[model samples]
Target: MLADTKKVGGFLLLAAALLLNGCKEEKAEVGAAAPALAAYDLQGNPASLEKWQGKHVYLNFWASNCGGCLVEMPVLEKLSKEFGDSIVVVGINTDKEEMNIQALLDERQVSFPNVRDQLAITQERYQVIGTPTAFLIDPQGKLTGQYIGMLHEPELKAIFEKSRQKG
Candidate 1:
C-alpha cells in the first residue's frame, strides 16, 4: 500500500507540472518581435504583421459588441487617414461570426484593414483581456506600447512621437 501511494503521488505531481507548462502565459513584451500569426482581413485577403514591415503599426484588438470598441472604430479610421501610408492601423476583430463583423464594419465605415480573429489566436498571443486593447509596433516591428483600454488621438500621437525618437 505504501509503494502504491508513493507512485500515485509522483504521478499527480508530474501531471500538475505538465498542466502548468501548457498554460504558459503569453504577452507581447516591449522590444520583442510581434507574433507572426496569420489571419484574413475583411476583404478575405491573408493578413499578417509581416505585411506591415518597416512601418509603424497600431494593432487594436476589439469585438463588434464591445461598447468601447464601437466608439474607437472611427477614431482608428481617422488615425489611418491622417497617418496615410506612413503608419498602419490594423484592427483585430474578435467577433465569432464573420457576418456580424461585416455588418458592424458596414455600419461604422471603418476603413482600416480589420483582420478576423475568429479563433482568438492573435488575441491570446497579445494577452488581450478586453476590447480596444492597442499595441504600438515600431518600424523595426518591436512592440513599443500596450494599451488595454480606449485610446484617443492625442495619446496615439504621443506614442508615435515617442516611437520616432526611439527608432
Candidate 2:
C-alpha cells in the first residue's frame, strides 16, 4: 500500500513540474529598446539605424551560410528596388566571417544596407531563434511586425505600405 502511495505521489509531482514548466513566460530584458545595429556598407562606411529614421525599415537577420537566406536575398533585392525611397531594407549578417558575407553580397549584387553581427547582441535582444527573421519598424521607431523565414516581395511591399500609412 505504501509503495502504491509513493508511486501516486511521484506521478503528482511530475505532473506539477510539467505544469510549472508550461507556465513559464519569455521575459524581455530591462531597458531593451530597438536593437542598435552598426554594420558597415559594401564600401566600408558605417551603416547605423539612426540614419533610417522617418522611414519604414525592414531589418533582416540572416547569414551567408543559411540556405534560406540565399533564396531570400533576390526577393529582398527586388523589394528594395521597388520601395527604394519609401522603405529601407537592411540585412544583418549572422555569420561570424565578414569575408563570406561580402562575397555573398557581391555575387548577389545586393545594394541595400548590409551589416555584420559582431557581438550577436541584436540577436539576443530580439530573441531571434531562427534565420531570416525580419523586423518591420515603423517610422516612429516602434516594432510594427515580425516575419520569420524567407519573405516574398509582395508580402514585404504590403508591410511597407501599411507602415507608410501608419507613419
Candidate 3:
C-alpha cells in the first residue's frame, strides 16, 4: 500500500511540473536581457546586437517568402534612417536562399543592415515562431517589447513611445 501511495505521489508531482511548464509562453521574456546575435551581414560583414549596446535596437526577424515581412522592410528601413543615432535597426533574414533575399533587398532598394539566419539559430534563440516578429530592445539590451505580425510606422512609433513612457 505504501509503495502504491509513493507512486501516486510521484505521479502527482510530475503532473504539477508539467502544468507549470505548460503555462509558460513560448516567446522571449520581456524585460529580460536580449540575446546577443552574432552573425554575418549580407555583405559578409560581421554584425551583432552587441555592437549596438548604446542605442535602442529594433531587431526584426523576417523571411523572403512572407508578404507581410516584405511590406515592413521598407518601413523599417525608412524609420531606421529617420531615427538615426538614437536607434539602430537590424534585420535577421531567415530565408535559406540568399538569392531570394538579395533579390528582394535589391528590388526594394533597402540599405538597412541585415544578416541571414541560415541555420535558424537566431530564430530559436529569440523564440521566433513566425516571420515579421520584432523585438524592441533598449539601449542596455533589455527586451522592451515583442510584436508579432506586420508592423507599420505608426504602431512602431507607439511602441517606442510606450517604452519611453515606461522606462
Candidate 4:
C-alpha cells in the first residue's frame, strides 16, 4: 500500500510540472527579433509584421468574448491614432467566427488594423495564454516588453515613450 501511494505521489508531481511549464508566461527577450507573423485581417487583407518595419509596433492578442480585451480596444485605438506615424497598433483577434469579430469591431469603433487569427496560429507563435496580451516591438523588430492583461493609457504611453527615446 505504501509503495502504491509513493507511486501516485510521483506521478502527480510530474504532471504538475508539465502543466505549469505549459502555462508559463511568454517572454520575448528585449534584443531578440520578434516572432514571424502572417495572417489576414477581418477584411481579408493580407498583412505581416514586416510590413510595419521601421516603426514601433503594439502586437495585441485578443478575443471577442474577453471583457478585458474589449476594454483594451479603445485604449489601443487611442494609441494607434495618436502615434499613427511613429507606431503601429495591430490587433490580432482569436475569434472563431469572422462575422462575430467584425460585429464587435464595428460596435467598438476600433479603427486599428485587426488581424484575424481563428486558427490560433499567431497566438501559439507568440505564446499567448490569455486575452489582451501585448508585445512592444522596436523599429528594428526586436521585442522590448510583453504585457499580459488590460493595460491602461499611461502604461501604454510609457511603452511608446521608451521606444521613442531609444530611437
Candidate 5:
C-alpha cells in the first residue's frame, strides 16, 4: 500500500511539471531573430515586418483605449520622421474596429505606418504584456530591446545608440 502511494505521488509531480512547462509563454529575446508580423493596415493594405528588412524598426503595440498608447503615438511619429529612411516606426493597433483606429490616428495626425491586430495574434507573437509595449529590431532583423509602458524620445535614442554599438 505504501509503494502504491509513493508511485501515485511521483506521477502527480510529473504531471504538474508537464502542465507548468506547457503553460510557459515564449517571448522573443534580444539578439534573436524577430518574429514575423503579418497583418493589414487600417486601409486594408498588406503590412508586414518583413517589408522594412534593411532598416532599424521601432515596432510598437498599442490600443486606442490605452492612455499611454495614445500619448506615445505622436512620439512614435516624431521618431519615424526624425529617423527618415534609417529607422521605420510601425504601430500595431490591437483594436477590434477599423473606424476607431482610424479616428484616433486622424485625431493624432499620425503619419507613420500602422497595422491592425484585431485578434491580437501579432501581440501574442511578440508576447506583449501591455498596451504600450514596444520592440526594437536592428537593421539585421534581430531584436534589441523590449519596452513595456510609455516610451519617450530620450529613452529610445539611448536604446538606439546602445543597439548600434552592439551591432
Candidate 6:
C-alpha cells in the first residue's frame, strides 16, 4: 500500500511539472515577420493576413461585450482614416454571436476592415489572452509591437511610426 501511494505521488509531481511547462508564456520578438493568418472579414468573405502585406497593419482582438473594445473601436476608426491607404486597421471580434458583433459595428460606425473570429482560432494563434490586444505589423509583414489595452492616439502613432521605419 505504501509503495502504491509513493507511485501515485510521483505521477502527480510529473503531471504538475508538465502542466507548468505548458503554461509558459511565449516571447514574441518585435520586428519578427508576421505569421500567415487565415480569417474571415465581417462580411464573411475569406481574408488572409498576407493580403495586407506591403502596408502597415494594425490587428485588434476585440469582443462586442468588452467595454474597452467599445471605446477602442472609434479610436481605431479615426486612426484608420488618418493613415488612409498607408495603414490597415483590422478589428477581429471574438464574439460567438454574429448579430451582436454586427450591431455594435453598425452602431459605432466602425469604418475599418472588421473581421469575426468565430472559433477564436485567431486568438489562439496570436496568443491573445485578453480583449483590446493590438498587433502592429510592418509593411514587410513583420510584427513591430503589441498593445494590450485601451490605446491612446499618441502611443498608437508611435507604433505606426516604428512600423513605417521598418519598411
lDDT of 1 by residue, 16-121 (tens): 8786545444457877987654468877777878888888888988887788888878877887887755688888988875457877787889878788877666
Q: lDDT for each of the candidates?
A: 0.78, 0.74, 0.79, 0.81, 0.79, 0.77
Q: After superposition, how far is residue 146 of candidate 4 from its true place, in Å?
A: 0.4
Tens digit per residue, CA lDDT, model 3, 134-155:
9989988898888999988899
Candidate with the larger lDDT of 1 and 4: 4
Error of 6 at 37 (Å): 2.3
User: Over 4 Å off in model 2, which ranges?
Assistant: 1-33, 38-47
Q: Residue 92 of candidate 1: its Cα lDDT?
A: 90
Clashing pairs in 1: none
Q: Candidate 5, residues 1-167: lDDT per residue as tens digits?
A: 99999999999999987865444444578889887764688778877777888888889888888998887777778777767557778888887864477777888999988898775657777888788999989888899888998877798777655655654
lDDT by residue for model 4 (1-167), tens: 99999999999999987865554434455568887764687768776888899999989998878898988788888878877878889998887853577777888899888888775656776888898898989888898889999988898888877777776
Q: Write the residue-wise lDDT of candidate 6 on 67-128 in tens digits.
A: 88887777788878877568889888887843567777788998788877776556766778
In lDDT terms, how accurate is model 1? 0.78
RMSD of each: 5.9, 10.3, 8.6, 7.4, 7.8, 6.4
TM-score of each: 0.77, 0.72, 0.75, 0.78, 0.76, 0.76
Number of the top-ranking candidate, with lDDT as the measure: 4
* Model 6's TM-score against the true structure: 0.76
Task: Determine the backbone clash count of candidate 6.
Answer: 0
**CA lDDT of 157 in candidate 6?**
74
